[model samples]
Target: MSERTHDGGVAVTAAPSPDESLPAADLAAKYGLAVSGARPSLVEYVRQLWGRRHFILAFSQAKLTAQYSQAKLGQLWQVATPLLNAAVYYAIFGLILDASRGMSHDTYVPFLVTGVFVFTFTQSSLMSGVRAISGNLGLVRALHFPRAALPISFSLQQLQQLLFSMIVVFLVVIGFGNYPRLSWLLILPALVLQFLFNTGLALIVARMGAKTPDLAQLMPFILRTWMYASGVMFSINHMLEGRPEWIVRVLQANPAAVYMDLMRYALIDGYGAVNLPPHVWALALGWAVVVFCGGFVYFWKAEERYGRG
Candidate 1:
């Protein structure tokens, strides 16, 4: 069999003449599966990711800093915006509606803060993903980096905001005398899961939005509707009142809602003593895997296309 070096590692063998059957090694080598150095498998994919973890971190940090660099407030906007939103909502819901009839006024602030904080990350991910390619057309055409990095960077920027918002939420919770409990430790893993979810979503939308700019305009309405449907202002349990079990199930199926509930339970309810249902967590995980794998495949398919202006 005729062999050629592929990527300076594997020997890729060409198909044999019509009369001769290619050996397995030759066939495998043809597909870049030679024993010497095979193409990456899923495990290798993760290892490759691990090796480049620094790049991701650095890129994300740079993006975060660059976004705020031009602003007078700089990174303080990350803390300020969420706090402002919480205050507005608190005024309307707490003062006008007196909505905290059952819940304490102070407790309601953190609850709303947590919901808005989490929802803002999702909004930023989806909205930025929608504009990712269009907004970075110059970078896309001029540079060669992972296309996923654009949306990933945007999501990470929002994640930085989320982290800052969480600090504010923690302070608000403390001031309210709601000291964190051991159960609050779950926030670490929950935040990780939330990040995975956001990255996956950004990947999906960035690719789709690259092809259709209309999504950029359409995303905000969708996000607003999602904010309402997600029970950001009121509790999901309250919204689902008198609705059928299946309807509640359908609403709960929203992975964002599940995460919101988890965040509320951990940070607000104190380690989910009320306990977010297992199915909710399972659904969140399932969506994360599906979105990540599917979006990665879809985005990678257009990797070469991203270079086109």
Candidate 2:
């Protein structure tokens, strides 16, 4: 380019560019630029999620608070909803079907309530997880935090609701002549393991739901079937009395059944260790660790695909 000098003579000059000889990739590297929504490494993703812990917690609390705000009973429905479910199950399974044949009324009532409350924890988690990503598309697209937070937050919200509902569980158990004891303390560990398991399951479903929004419509039937197979209203041992040994073992080993069995044994006086399959605690831990880790990795795998076309 030519420029006029003060002396009126034409001057030819050129400016040098540092990036003139570099390719696009090299230029991006030189400027420390990264793709806007590229997936991070697994370790980095974990770190990112950890850094956003406050957001996860706050979001969960906010969701939980707003969950029934518009209802007449508000949060009372959290406890009442499951209790009502227990009543219906008790009527059909306990009275009409004689599912509670072995257990007395005192034992059966608390048993059914505990099972309903505990299983609802997982059921709600999975249901919310299916909508976590798809339901919050606006937030996912508008924010840059780890997508896992959405599902994790929803799981946390369910856990919070379960904790609130447990007060009734305690009263029902006490009302049934099962007083507070050391074993009741076992609920803490059981709840923790269940939370881990639920969170993991939520992560898995969140990813699936994001890819196929129609999955939300189908989850209710799947969950209802799971509830029946989980022995929510009846004992697997009692109901499957004549079934094959392998079938009983498989049903007892199911994570949902395992968790419910643990809680029932811990809370109900009639549900002794004999009611639980061999190594029930070990099964609970295994399910929690396996599902939580697997779900985290599975959800993280599709991190970049969330909120995309």
Specify the highest-lDDT model's number: 2
Q: Please, what are the lDDT tens digits per residue for candidate 1 over residues 127-149? A: 87778887889877776456667
All candidates' TM-scores? 0.79, 0.94
For candidate 2, the TM-score is 0.94
How would you encode candidate 2's per-residue C-alpha lDDT over 107-135 as one tens digit per residue?
99999999999999999999999999999
lDDT of 1: 0.75
Runs with alpha carbons beyond 4 Å of true place in candidate 2? 1-21
lDDT of each: 0.75, 0.94
Clash pairs, model 1 backbone = 272-275
> Per-residue lDDT for 11 in model 2?
96
User: For model 2, where is the 10-residue window of minimal lDDT?
Assistant: 12-21
Q: What is the Cα-based TM-score of model 1?
A: 0.79
